[model samples]
Target: MKFGDMELYILSDGTLTEDGGGIFEYYPKNIWASYEVDGMTPYRTDEHNNILAAANCLLIRHPEGNVLVETGVHDKTLNYVKYHNIVKNPSLMESMKSAGFKPSDIDIVINSHLNPDHVGWNTVIEDGRLKPTFENAKYVIQKKEFRKAMDPGFELKNDYFSAEEDVLPLEGSGTLELVEGEKEIFPGISVIPTPGHTSGHQSVMIRAERTMLYAADMAALVMHQEKPRCKMAFDALGREECWRTKKKLLYDRAAENSWYTYFYHETSFSVGIIHKITNTRGEMEGRVEKVEIL
Candidate 1:
């Protein structure tokens, strides 16, 4: 949707299927079992009856230049079972083109963290060499997250290859900017520290007269924002900090009347707002409304 002079668009590289257990591993089985599913349909499982999971990405644009929040898994690297049916699709680039942009036209690439799903398109593998996919843009990453990913002894699993490929090369080429908390990267766009999921994880906040907080993995799904106490199994800092941040930000956005609140893994609509309402018991509750992706 249009916000001031900036034009925001949601572009899908594609979709990835995950297991509910993997996504929410920290919650007790009984608690997860009792959790209610609302509005959306749960992923159908095999005969075993396990719940499935999926996620998408968001791309935003302003008159100053194009900013891509996350890059979907590129075509050749989708073979890993972690992501079902992952294939190189020009959908992201195509969508950008349809929106009047070429890959080279993107001026900035903001990665929430070094996660594989988020940095997949950081580079395009060609002839055994890794290169920046968006050649002209400056890649923005948190300083601490870069150091963690660069540790030689760190396990390469959980999509860490994204760090070896997409992120490091940019740093080497002098195209990466490492920022600390609340640093402005582009006009009206700032990077805010929201660690917990990863030691250096971050979220993007866009400001005009109103604000748009891109919660990133800070609150992956609507459920996390709605029920901030619910922690994800994949969280690195333990669930306590993650939940605390979620609750605080959910309330902060409402109090400030942020124009939009965006989540990285929300399926229905990638960009939206969370409203706080009081229930019959006079308890505060969060309700999400999907914003039109312009």
Candidate 2:
């Protein structure tokens, strides 16, 4: 988990399940089910073809402070996940503590997007009011994403962004800092705009002696990294744009063995080096190698 002098570790806020058909929107159930993600609970699909998924959050132990990227789904979402027979784990706070930190120990939180599973820990219902979980940390997100999450039409994204439960409380906390495209969130870390997954979806980029872009749900699982052009149903905003983002991240930036990549929801291998593979015809593409921290 140590990339040079920088430190990194993954914490589980627990796991959840999604309609396998829902996450990989464009792919048929047969094609997707054919792909397998090791280290993940053997994906159990229900009559609806839903599969259990993990909410693996990344933590960066930087000298500036500790940064947590993404969180698990709220307990409120358990019924849906359990209906598929997938089990949830401890709270994000307990997971952090078990990993030797506390909720208040987090210095900054980078939400890849406004999705419920990604931003659930942003606020916790306490005393009948939404309360900030990390009192001292600043919450960062793309400015464009914040705007998109607030738009009326985005109500369709309510499952991803709960206005009253998630957004307003964090926005009102004065700890929220909306980042412009590719802006640094302190030092050692930056964000790249990946708009197709959501109107303002962004991926976290860490740079120090080494570099790694937390691809987030962009590659919801390792299979996407193995296949960049793969499509997802949840990409309601920009399908083509999302595909371009995948190419730019996996084939371009992550090409030439320049940087490592992290898949937020990848159950088995969340972080790895994406190697650009060249076939006999000299055509090029990207796929992950060196699966680590399973």
Give the distance in Å from residue 252's predicted Cα in candidate 2 to where it truly belongs: 0.7
Q: CA lDDT of 60 in candidate 1?
A: 64
Residue-level lDDT tens digits of model 1 in 155-192: 43554655676677777676788887778877899888
Q: Over the stretch 1-294, how does candidate 2's per-residue lDDT look in tens digits?
A: 886566888887777677787777777767777676553334457677877677888899987789899866655555644654445567677778888998888889888888677777788889988877888888888888777777737356555546556766888788898988888875878888877777778888888776787878777776777666676777756667787777877677776565788876666666787777876667775666655552
Q: What local lDDT score does residue 13 receive in model 1, on the 0 to 100 scale? A: 69
Compared with the true structure, the alpha-carbon lDDT of candidate 2 equals 0.74
Best-matching candidate per lDDT? 2
**In model 2, which range of ten residues has the least summed lDDT?**
35-44
**RMSD, one per candidate, in order:** 3.0, 2.6
